[model samples]
Target: QQQVKQSPQSLIVQKGGISIINCAYENTAFDYFPWYQQFPGKGPALLIAIRPDVSEKKEGRFTISFNKSAKQFSLHIMDSQPGDSATYFCAASKRTDYKLSFGAGTTVTVRA
Candidate 1:
């Protein structure tokens, strides 16, 4: 039940379009949800995160919508740009857990 499942292994979007990725978890014990973005040769960087208490959270062009009852969460990129093209991963972890349960990454490409 510590698994985070993500959808759409790949996505292609036009510049200025919206990019969306979805994830679901089966573990109710998870309390922290975070999204990570990784470039070609760099480590994954934390993009945005949300707690189970928050229904939604937004930062710049990135937004996270969480559903506690459904055990699902999603990420939305508004006005997607070429620079936004990257591999994104959704992860869940509990405060007591030392590691995070990660979803299969979604590779997004934003074409101009």
Candidate 2:
């Protein structure tokens, strides 16, 4: 069962454009929010994350925007490139709990 809901099952973006993925959760107990990026024949890797305390967190071209009151969060990929193509998953979990509930995932294709 997935506690998180994500939109746009897939998307195509041109190189140097921005790709945005949105996710929402109903569980208020969730304190840890992370976005995972997975490539073919590879496991998902943690891209970026943000907690309830912060409205946003940015690292390089990847950014995580969080809204505590709405229980929603988003991932913004800047300067999309062919190498950035992958399946992205939004996940949420409590700090004390090791288990995570993930969204269906969005496949992003960056066109050169």
**Counted clashes in each candidate structure:** 0, 0
Angstrom error of the Cα, residue 11, model 2: value is 0.3
In model 2, which runs have C-alpha deviations exceeding 4 angstroms? none
Q: In terms of TM-score, which candidate is strongest? A: 2
lDDT tens readout by residue for model 1, 27-112: 89999999999999999999999999889999999999999999999999999999999999999999888999999999999999
Q: Per-residue lDDT of 1-112 in model 2, one digit per residue for the tens?
A: 6799998899999999999999999999999999999999999999888889999999999999999888899999999999999999999999999898999999999999
Clashing pairs in 1: none
Local error of candidate 2 at residue 96 (angstroms): 0.2
Q: What is candidate 2's TM-score against the reference? A: 0.98
Candidate 2 Cα RMSD after full superposition onto the native fold (Å) = 0.7
